[model samples]
Target: MKFTVAICTYNGQDRIPEVLDGLQQQTNPEGIEWEVVVVDNNSSDRTAEVVSQYSKNWRGDSQLRYVFEATQGAGYARQRAIQEAKSDLIGFLDDDNLPKENWLVEAYRFGQEHPQAGVYGGIIHPKLDVPLPPYFNKIKSLLAINNPGSQPFRYQRNDKPRKVPAGAGCVVRQQAWKERVPKQLQLQGRDEKNKKTLLIGNEETEAFFYIQNSDWEIWHNPAMEIWHHLPSKRLEKEYLLKLSRGFGLANHKLRMVRLYPWQRPLMILLTPLYLLSDGYKLASYYLRYRHEFDSDLTKACELQARIGRFMSPFVRA
Candidate 1:
């Protein structure tokens, strides 16, 4: 089976080399084909040039190609990668993510076994560039670091939708994307030029829901591993607050079906109660973890998120 591994970047020139090197070292099964496609998300730096250098010097079994996506958001880059991909299975990796040696092979095996699966993703351990705060352990999930388990489980149709596979280090099936990620479901990720604003961005998570609704399954594979590099700036209070609000906005955007546009106003009206409930929950979390974390970062995030969710209909829809 052929595989298209996509790496989306914005001003990631220096880090792209390590990610490319990791892909180069992948140990795919003999005769199985794989390639890495680097999508430059309108980078201001030499990201394109660096990737081109690696592409020209590639000596591994996998092929390497570079695509310049003039669009400014990571969402646009991801969509372009899907369009440029030629394989039945498309694996996504961020510019700083370093995948394990057997990532491709394991993904291929899972895809072969579960033709019904829509997406597959695994652990995202932190590769910190700075010291972790005492509260870091209590709030790591906010950082997008996930480690579900060490087994593979295909999701089933349950009352509540299954948990979304984390966006990083995941492989998406072409059939699933074609069925779910059409124009109706497309959502913009971050806008690189406007660095100050935090917009909605649970794009991959929303896609999994669409695919599941289309009678497709989502799987979590523990064997597929990658490192998510986190810098000191990301751990700051201001950035964390923005991320919290972004999460709130993204959650609302991901679930609000424009097909039922009439319901948006109702949701918007009920936002206050939801935020109040969230406030109560925030208090509970603080009471539970106050000894560990001194600040009410999580509480502030929830309030901001509720505000964003209330505004999601106007902002994204």
Candidate 2:
């Protein structure tokens, strides 16, 4: 097969239909074989039943398959998708992500052209239900929405701080993933089922780090695009702060994953320096926005992320 679209979702019974409908509208390339697989990540809701209903009358050229992943994390669900996929190239979409008509063709074409790219992602535009805050753009990336530019580019690891594609609207080569990524990642991603679970993330970045360590390149493909639906709940101050903190908490682990064994000791020693830097940023941000801090959700979220980063070392994975 040419491509497999893997939708990983948990408790997404209400959200999966829109994504499926978007996929059904894809402008497929002639003779290009592709299929869609919905991996249910241990949902307590009727996610399976919803997919099952679709499978009954699925009229698309591609087959719609359902797989259950008992594991609770996004990483595990994606890993399961890779194992079950018949295609060498896999495009991932969260249940809330809706692709444009040309998204699949663009994603497949990019992979064909760039054989060296182990993993790549495209522009994610937010489809917010509520009015965006004035400063929402400041922390919008925390919501997994990004647009590097109109041009496609390779992400160089040598850049001061490394950057990798978010799992949403991302495509990965099966070979690279099977060879480089470990079955179990240090960060297992968020468990929506567990209310008290730490909002730890970076599972996708961790896998990308392994793939990047090899000869494969990571890229940003602007041609491929998707709309990430953001409900009002996600815009709430509490949710955004938690999301930021989760990303921050996973920062240290990702740093360690990207480093060589010899480099880890030095990274550990530099923990104090990192903490001081994060502390400075936090203090400076608070000082600048103290008057509006309570009302400024974006600023408050930034502060929470900084705090998470400062405490990352002490927090066990």
Candidate 3:
């Protein structure tokens, strides 16, 4: 089967080298042909330079091509990838990740085994510089929260050909793309109801649901793994707060599909406790590492708390 690996990049020159090297190391399949197509989202950095170097120097049958997406967001880049892809089976790897040597081979194998499966996703593990704190670890295990200590993960489906949706290190079957992603994703945004805005974090998740609801399966194989590098600049408390606020925005947008109203009350009751507990733990780390706390961190926390309140009302709809 022929496959095209679609990569969406923005100012990702520093990280592209590792991703390129990892693809080069793939044990080439005999009859299977694969190539990497990078969609550059108006990068002002040396991304084009790095990709050009790889095209010239890399010794592989897999072709490399770069397309410019003048649009600003990731959704725009990904949309272009769908249109530009050469094969029906598409592999997606972020610029900041290194897929396992067998990533493509395994994905293709799974596709062959399950002809009806449209979306195939794999495991994403954080490449952390240091171990997480004890308290943070405990809270993570207890609360089932996902963040620095844990990478986003979906369980293998209970039913065969299940709906597993996560974008980080995954493959998309062409039929699945035509049926689910492009149309709804264009309208959905982060919320299921707000079909006007571009979908953010939950694009992949919603696609999985659509696939399963339409009678196709989603698969998650643990063996298909990718090492996701955490941005060094994002290792601070301020950064986590920013990340949390961004997550809150996505969550608030998603809450608009609420079937019940008590969701807001639940958030109101729970937000303070979560903030105090997680906040104190984060503060301890900030004090120890940066030796100073700033207003951005405070603002991020406030945004998250307020977002929770804002989301509560939507739950009733």
Candidate 4:
């Protein structure tokens, strides 16, 4: 079976090389027909030039190709990648994500073994450039650093506080995505041009919701793994708070996607109940940790997220 590795980037000229290097060092991909496609999402930097230069001297068995996507948004870029891909199985990697040497083989093997799986993701360990902040574990998920133990398991579809795989280092069945996901998603991820205004996320989760609603299942494969490089800026309180709020804002839309059209009104009516619970938690958290709130980035992020969720019903889809 053929496979495609798609790296979606925006102004990631400096970070894309290391990811390419990781792909180049794959251990055992002899029989597998795989190629790497870099989708440049309206980058203002020298990303195109760097990928072109690398493609000229790429030594891996897989051919390196670059595709430019004029429309800005992670969702758009990924959609373009799916269309341009030559293989039915596509693995997505962010420009900053570095995979292990056996990532390609393992990811492909898992997909081959499980035809029922529409989407699957593996462990993501953080490669931090800065020191860990107080209560880092509480907000580490915002950075897409996930390690859900060593065993592989299918994600429960009916679980509250739903668990979905992060876009980073995740593999998808092209047929599943094409059949279920819409051409234009409500949550389009962060747009570079409107960086200050747009913070809404969960474009991938929205897609997963549609896929899981069908006969497909989502799984977590322990054998495949990647390291997400986190710079100091991502660890800053401001960025973390913004990320938390973005995720919270997307929660309602995701909830609506999972429910039937008839159940949406009930979900909307239940929004106040969710807000009340979140409000109590936020207030209690502030009261208990008033003194440490300033320094405790995790608590601050949680409060911001709660506030975002409270305002989610009003936010336009």
Best by TM-score: 2
Off by over 4 Å in 1: 156-162, 184-186, 257-294
Which lDDT value does model 4 have at 185?
88
Which has the greatest lDDT? 2
Tens-digit lDDT string for candidate 2 (140-201)? 88889899989999998777778898889999999999999988888888877775335455
Estimate the TM-score for candidate 2: 0.94
State the displacement of the C-alpha of residue 50, model 1, in Å, after optimal TM-score superposition: 0.6
Clashing pairs in 3: 161-217, 162-218, 187-195, 189-198, 189-199, 260-315, 260-316, 261-316, 264-312
Question: Which ranking of candidates, highest lDDT first?
Answer: 2, 4, 1, 3
lDDT of each: 0.76, 0.87, 0.62, 0.86
lDDT of 4 by residue, 75-112 (tens): 88989999999988899999999999999999999999
Per-residue lDDT of candidate 3, residues 179-238 (tens digit): 765353522222212222222444556555555555566666555677776654545665
Please count the clashing residue pairs in each candidate, in the order shown. Answer: 0, 0, 9, 0
TM-score of each: 0.86, 0.94, 0.70, 0.94
Compared with the true structure, the alpha-carbon lDDT of candidate 2 equals 0.87
TM-score, prediction 4: 0.94
